[model samples]
Target: MSIENDLTEFISRDVVPEGGVTETELLISSGKVDSLGLLQILGFIEQQYGVTLLTSGSPKDFESVQTLASAIRKARGESA
Candidate 1:
């Protein structure tokens, strides 16, 4: 599966309990995702994309599927 697809799946199964996440939704602010969830997401990104996420970066990096995909791309040295 693509990174976005995988991430969407993860968010659906792990983050949101009832509804679901949209690409542009504010995951952190929506009460759908929390700090522990962010750690899981970072781990998922690292394992799935084979890159270490910078701990020094902003929380915005894990804000949504779209933004996370861009962060993964940038981490892989691809143009974001």
Candidate 2:
């Protein structure tokens, strides 16, 4: 699957709680994810894509699908 799809599925299945909604929406702005969820998502990305995610500044930097995908591509040494 594409990286976006993988990210969407991960957010839908793992991050969103019951009766919650997940999309390419502003996850941080919407408060859909907390600090713990951010960490979990980072770990999930690392485990799934076989890449390490290093945090710089705030964890919110990795909050959105686009940001996470870019990070993954960077970790894989692929063009983003």
Instruction: Evaluate all candidate structures by whole-model CA lDDT and list the values in order.
Output: 0.79, 0.73
lDDT of 1 by residue, 36-63 (tens): 8877877887787786776635667767
List, residue by residue over 1-80, the lDDT tens digit for candidate 2. Answer: 88878887888788886544444577777788887887788788778888767543245546678777776786678987
Model 2 stretches astray by more than 4 angstroms: 18-23, 55-61
TM-score of each: 0.83, 0.77
Q: Note each model's CA RMSD in angstroms.
A: 1.6, 2.5
On a 0 to 100 scale, what is the lDDT of residue 32 in model 2? 85
Instruction: State the lDDT at 2 in candidate 2.
Output: 81
Clashing pairs in 2: none
Q: Which ten-residue region of model 2 has the weakest summed lDDT?
A: 54-63
lDDT of 2 at 15: 85
